[model samples]
Target: MKISYLLILLSLTLGTPSQIDVSEVRTAYIKASGDEQAVEQLNSKLISVTTTDDKVLVAYKGAVGTMMAKYAKGLKDKKSLFKEGVSLLDYAVTSDSLNVEIRCIRLSVQENAPKITGYKKNIDDDKAFILKNYNSMTDEGAKKFVKGYALRSKVFNDNERQLFQGL
Candidate 1:
């Protein structure tokens, strides 16, 4: 009975915004790869995830819209998604210059997206920003998450990877 209650309580508290874990969020994202339904569900969660009137919250919401665009096939659909995502990301970084995680999300989207979409323009600048400041992020989880993603990304060259790994 005690174990049952503990499990229930744990479940209840874990979903709360205050308890939201970004590392776990990133892990779940990685696990959901190639799973359409899982991606949709996770994207929905990102859209709904709460933040304290902060850039991270805005960025997550924007990222969800961007993910929705990823699954969209039409040119118009992708355009709409890109606009919302990029705008939110820009707003986030503008509001909080130190939001490396938010910038990471924006950079990832821009770097992988095609050049025709006009979203790739920030790829170099965001990469430079991330490389320059990521090591100094106070959040250990953020640092680890960014470094892991940057290492795997083709957008970052050997020098960038070396910088990430060195950190």
Candidate 2:
């Protein structure tokens, strides 16, 4: 009975499940016809992603890049947003291209476009690194960090309200 109890305790102790954060991006729908409310809504959503994690910052920066790229040909003289996006993108990429999801978000932004000057090799390297680290990270907090990055990556669009989805 003592042996059996010890074996059971060992199994129970060793059976702890791996940790991960399940985050969702909240989505809303606004006018694609360039309404102020829609733009405001998108900006609000983007603003909400401001957090402490360096990875989240990088991911949000990528999202900002995508938005600036989309609105570049449309906005009248608001070169500010585009400039901000460029700065953020450069900062994030330089800070750590090993951030896979952030790099992926950057790629989805317009960096992958043929006319753009972005390179795929950087993204590929980041992706590989992220996957390797992700697979190896068993800590709940680290997993949550990765999930948050992923959540931020998918939470934007050319439309204004698309930014608020799944939150």
Candidate 3:
């Protein structure tokens, strides 16, 4: 009961300006388990997910839409499923710059180990952008955003180097 209340409070208080699909957010949030790492990831993702269909949002959007679309296609299609998962991961990271777990999850999304090398550049780009801009954010209400960003950078740097190396 206490956990449920906490989750609700977190969701209500942290909601972004864009209309968040509450049900979808809840579905994603519950997967966090009691693990601090997963919770951190979910917290980041909440900020990035937006309901507005704007070009800016779409440009920065990752693989979430593709992943959700593919998931809707069912599990029988292995190739599609794998690609979709990767896309979702990309979206998750794109949406929540602070969610570091998405970086870790990206590892399992790629089938070929060699492809990991290719992704290094992208990850490096992300890291540069994050490190460069995060300091500019100063609003007290957005401290959680800053915290999440730092946490993601540390985790991705330490645990998911292949993904972060490209940035």
1 versus 2: better TM-score goes to? 1
lDDT (Cα atoms) of all candidates against the true structure: 0.73, 0.45, 0.42
In model 1, what lDDT does residue 58 have? 68
lDDT tens digits, residue span 56-165, model 1? 76676666666677788898988898788777777887788677887887787776666776777777777888888886799887788788879988889997798877
Off by over 4 Å in 2: 1-40, 48-55, 73-83, 96-98, 110-114, 117-121, 137-167
lDDT of 2 by residue, 7-43 (tens): 8886555432121111221122113113455544444
Question: Would you list the clashing residue pairs of candidate 1?
Answer: none
Residue range with the least summed lDDT across 10 consecutive positions in model 1: 45-54
Q: For residues 52-137, write the lDDT of model 3, one tens digit per residue.
A: 44322332222333233233445556345345444545665666655333432332222212342244335555555545554454
Candidate 3 positional error at 157, Å: 5.6
Best by TM-score: 1
Question: Per-residue lDDT for 166 in model 1?
Answer: 61
- The 10 consecutive residues of candidate 2 with the worst lDDT sum are 17-26
List all candidate RMSDs to the true structure.
5.6, 16.2, 10.9
